[model samples]
Target: MADSTQVFAILAVTLAAFVWGRFRYDLVALAALLASVLLGLVPADAAFLGFGHPAVITVVAVLVLSRGFERSGLVDLIAEQALRVGDRLILQTLVLSGTVLVLSGVMNNVGALALMLPVAIRLAREHDSPPSLLLMPLAFGSLLGGLTTLIGTPPNIIISAYRQDLVGEGFGMFAFFPVGACVALAGLLLIVLAGRYLVPQRAGQASLDAMFDTAHYLVELRVPEGARAVGWSLRDLHQAIEEPVPVLAVVRGEARHPGHTFHGHLRVDDILLVEAGPEEMALLEDKAGLEVGPEPPAEDGDGGGDEAGTVDTEGLQLVEAVVRNDSMMLHRTVGQLRLHNQFGLHLVAVARDGGRLNQRLRDIRFRPGDVLLLQGGEGEIGESLATLGCLPLASRNLSLGQPRMLLVSVAIFAVAVIAMVLDWLPAAVALTGAALASLLAGVLTLREAYQAIDGPVIVLLGAMIPVGQALETSGGAALIADALLALGRDWPVVATLAGLFAIGMLLSNVVNNAAAALLMAPIAASLAEGFGVSPDPFLMAVAVSASSAFLTPIGHQSNTLVMGPGGYRFGDYWKLGLPLSLAVMAVAIPLILIVWPL
Candidate 1:
């Protein structure tokens, strides 16, 4: 017998702390673990064992493999093809959702979603449609797709590892595929048919003429005599100017090459056809010691220029870009990163979460959600933006760099997954080897590998494992299971399974899904024993429910990520999400009973 009072008290306090949200979940979990150790609820020697658990290794391995797939640009290639289908809104949704579902089954759903997002935005812009209608459906599709495989989501891995510890065997690679596929198909159908109605139709029609906005200015630069520009051809000058601007034309006295050649040679008196705004033109003139020709005529209402041909400074404009979570510039400060010195762009202002920021630009640490307002010559800014991993407010031409080491990255990742699946090596060893190989082969740097992993999630998992073990050792799980069984003595096995599923779903919404699964699995087994039935169905029910957290933005990282971009309020999610959640519950309960019968 266990002291029920002490166990319940600890449980209450932990749940309260999680709901508070003031402290980090990992730190709270660690505090709980230490408290348990002090109370002698868990053995001190066994306290840290969960950090070395197989589930953790499997999760880490899956993350690394997902990163490898993303770096290969295979997902990007697929998304580009999806964009070319030119399907109707309904048909486009079906195609995009279906593609993401299939791709996510083979790779990480988050990676799949990230690759598809730009395509979704592009489609929305093409059709003059609101992204609100498509983005939520895509996010839901990514979540549903994770059900198709064992390594599809962290919850699945935790459940499978837990099962192995209890029953001496784990789920096979395709164990969950049949039922999961059915659920995913049904979910996809619902979103395709009814999702449009659920989402607001706020997208008004856009004019064809206004499709491409000329927010950037176009100006011409002239090469001066006895200057560096005099000896350089347009192509050489374009390459030498390491800014965002491009050389659009080359005017040589009476002759002009509108379709400029990159290899064209230069000589004295050659009028270099260069395209740049005032800022870049100024920079070029200063750097190469060249001079500009007479300025173009002023507007009808504006006063004429001075003898030296200076234009109004008011014509210059600035644009802002929000730094996305996936941006390489996330965590760097403006000065440390040297945006101005290296890229020839100046940071004028930054906006965070819709609020104007006044922090010193140099001292401001860049986070994923921060928006930067920059002032620079528009042409050079666009090209330099690529090197900084920043997306432009307007669509600009992009250069797809050579995908060197892509094949080596794929091969190494394949070997790691194969080694783990074949039981030839531990998953941790395989993934560690693959991460190192990627670095050695120059597929990803060590810094990039670290950046790819979600630190908060890892910490939450590591800290909560010890706390979950404490709950089990203190007989908390058994007590809760017994109480539930007593209350539902007359209920059918399916009803008991449903109740367990509901509890798991609730717990996952509040805490981390892996932690919820680890804490609930043993209790589910105890409940099955009390009812004199197989525990497999009940455990599977818990597993599915734990991973199905679609109600709130905070329930999943994907939900949180789309909140800002989709312009969604906290309540907007449950409009479509509530129905989806209920549908999953209704379908999943029956499927669990049919597939793994009690």
Candidate 2:
């Protein structure tokens, strides 16, 4: 009883930490593992072995292969081509969400979602809706797709292993298809029609134009020769104006330094990039002797940009690009890259951590996922960004991607899936081989592959494994199981399955689904034995319930993965998730009863 109490305390604290978000999930999980060991709930020696567990290894491998596939441009090519499907909102939701659903069955759910997310975002913009409208549904689709196959998700794989331990034979690859497919189709239909509306319209740092209010606020002012602004400090110009026009950058002779109202002296031929309206521009021009120069000259399919920053505003255009995880710009300051001198483009602003940066643009280092606002000739900006490994959000073109790398990555992934399904090699071993092949083929760099692994998710999975075993060993799971069974003891067989399913869904929503599954599998088997029925129905109930954790972001990694990109808050999940979970339970219970015959 004391051991059970300690395990419960440990888990309670872990759940609170996961929801708090004050600490990273990985740290919270590691703390739980240490607490379990110190409390003697889990043996010291077995605690760290989860790092090498098949599930952990497979997850990391899946992450690497995901990175490889992303670099290969296979998903991009398909998504680009898929643009022809239709432009209507309903048609787009079906195409993108349906694609994710199918892909999740064939690859890691998070990985499949990763490939589809940007595509969904593009489609959302095309349909004139917020990405929030699409991402949550796509995330849910990934979860539903995982239900259909043994290797589709970790929960299903764990359930299969438990079945084998109990009955000498496990579920085959397609054993889950009947129930899972039914549930998935129903969920997809519901999300297509209703759940999409549940997702809120959140405007975040998805575009640079939005970040700077560029359409109305940005303007260029030049200090022509013999102008009074050439003799006055930029600070003086700021003090003279009634309305504030924030200077974005100063384009000087052959060099552009980030501009500030309090820094540097304006010279003849110097151009100031500022965010202001025509009224504010007239105010600045009247007070500071600045002229609103004509727009820069236009360039045609070439890297020409008005003779190195002196040209009128004809050829220049603003672009928003994201620093990809594999970008060469990672850790390098904009000044170091000499974007103006070397790339012939002006670095107007960068958005980091969902906040706009207007000061110290040059010294600021680039990180993956940083959104950059750039200006130059269209062709030059595209070429320079491609060389820097930056992906332009404004344009979803993949013409610059390597076709050979794409083919090699797909071939390697195919071999890995075949090896896992045929049982020639374990899932971990097969995927590790594929990841290595991806590295050798130059589909992903070693650093990029390492970064691809969601460190917190992997660590959380590793730490939770031992804690889950401790729950069963310490008899805490039995404690909960006995009470729940007592409540449902006299109920009909189907009611018992429903009771177990409800509890599994609730627990999985509060904690990591895999850990929830691991903790409940033994208790589920205990219930099936007491009823003198095949454990298949109960086990299948636990499996589906655990994977159906849609009520919160913490319940599943796929949901968490999209939360930031979709700009969703913690509370936003239940808007769509509650109904979806209810729908799953409605379809799953009858299907389980009919298929397994409790």
Candidate 3:
């Protein structure tokens, strides 16, 4: 009883910290674990054993394999093959959402979403609508798909293992399919047939033509005599700066040929009408000793003689590309890439959500769905794009991924998945083997494999596992179960189940999904004991509700990811999400009772 008080106090402080959001949730969980240990709630010898838990190992391994899937180009291959997906809106939504749903079940749903996001944009282009119209459905579909398998999501994995501890046997890989499969199918159909109508069609992504009264990052600089830029051709000077900044005009005594010119020879005292971000503009002043303020054209020849003949643009061309999920440049800025010095390519302009940027190039972080206007030679730019993992947006076809490696990666992953399903090895062993195989098979590098793991997520699971065990060991779970029983004492058993489901889902939206599952699952077991029924239905309900966080972007990482790319307002989720959450409750309760029995 004293132990219960200590554990309850620690959890309350932990919950408050999470809601405060001053620190990350993982840090909060870790602090709670440490607190529990100090209070003698969790044994010191077993304090760090949560790090070795099967669920943690499986999640880390799954993340590594998800990276392999992304790098292999196979997921992209599927998305590309679905190019002709369908014609009408309903058919298109069905085919696209169904594909994501299936893909989400096998791999990390985020990876699945990343692989398919470009395809969603392409589909929106074909349909002549904003990406918002399609992206929300895709994001929601990815979340729903996670409900159908033990390894499908973190919440499901946690629930399965908790059952394992309770009954001395865990759920099989496909155990969730019996009921969750039905819910997923019904939810997806509603998304296709009815839910889409609620999604607003805001032009939130990749519209480069006159979308707004955008910024004109126009600045001017003058080339000084004896400067490094003097006597060099315009092409040489342009190449010197890399590509984030564009030279709008080369003014020599007002005899400029073209204002938005690509290349020309530089003369001493030449005034450059530069249209570029502040970083590049600063670079021009510092690197080339160019002075501020535009000057009149030079007193020399008109320089209009060559017209299009003098500047050699045969190999060099401007390419427009959109950042993909696997891009190294994701969340990085132009200055970080050193585009001019490293790749001889320059970022001319970047357009996001059909508008220009107001932030300086150095300050603005790159995000997926941004359309970058690049200037460089064909070979150099193409190689750079491949290295950066960006997809060409224009009609030009440039393949940046290695399709040949896809086969090897799939085989490596399949061996592990089969091993797990067939009970040939534990999930952790099989999946850890697959992650190592991915490295040995050359699907991904060791550094990339390490980067693939979400450090915060791993820490959260490790810390929360011990915290949860402490809660159960101290009878806090039973106490909460008694409270829940009191709340529904006069209600029917199914109604009590419904109340638990609502509580779990509401908590999930408020907290992290895995945390919700951990907190609710044991209470659900106690609820089952109180009602004199099997705990399977209650556990299943907890899993379902924990994964049903659809009311807000903050609920799930996937939803938050789509928020920027889809250009959705925070309140936009409920337009479709509210109905979908209701549908889950409407469908999941009956399915759970039928599959597991009350």
Winning model by lDDT: 3
Candidate 2 regions exceeding 4 Å error are 161-172, 196-212, 216-248, 253-395, 399-407, 441-443, 560-572
The residue-level lDDT of candidate 1 at 347 comes to 64
Error of 3 at 421 (Å): 3.2
User: lDDT tens string, model 1, 1-598?
Assistant: 3554565676678778866655656667777766777777767887777777877766766676677666666565667777776848888889888888887776667767766766776787777677667777887888788888777777777777777877887765557777778888888888899889886543431211122122222344566666776566543554465443444445567775532233466555554333344566776777665566546556621354333343323333344454543455666776567665577665655545334444444457775545455555666765565456554443222222236655776688778768767878655576668877877777666655665665555666666677666666667778888899888888877777889999988887776677678788888988888888887888888778887777776565556545544545567778888888788888888988898988
Query: What are the C-alpha RMSDs, in order, of all predicted structures?
Result: 9.5, 7.5, 7.1
How would you encode candidate 2's per-residue C-alpha lDDT over 1-598 as one tens digit per residue?
4999998899888878866645556788899999999888879989898788776777788778767767788777767765666667677777877888887776678778766776776766666666677778888999999899776787776777668667966666678889999999999998999865787777665333356445344566889887777867655675677433456567887776655323578888888877554556677878787887656545421233331223333223666766654456767876578665577666666766445765555457775557677776655676787677665656455442698898898899888878867878766678789999999889989978876776666777788888977887888877877787788878887787888899899988876677777777888887887778999999999989999989987677677656645656678899889999889999999999899887
- Worst-scoring 10-residue span by lDDT in model 3: 306-315
**Model 3 alpha-carbon miss at residue 478, Å:** 1.4
lDDT of each: 0.66, 0.74, 0.75
Worst 10-residue lDDT window for candidate 2 reads: 300-309
What is candidate 1's local distance difference test score?
0.66
Winning model by TM-score: 3
Q: Alpha carbon lDDT of residue 356, candidate 1?
A: 44
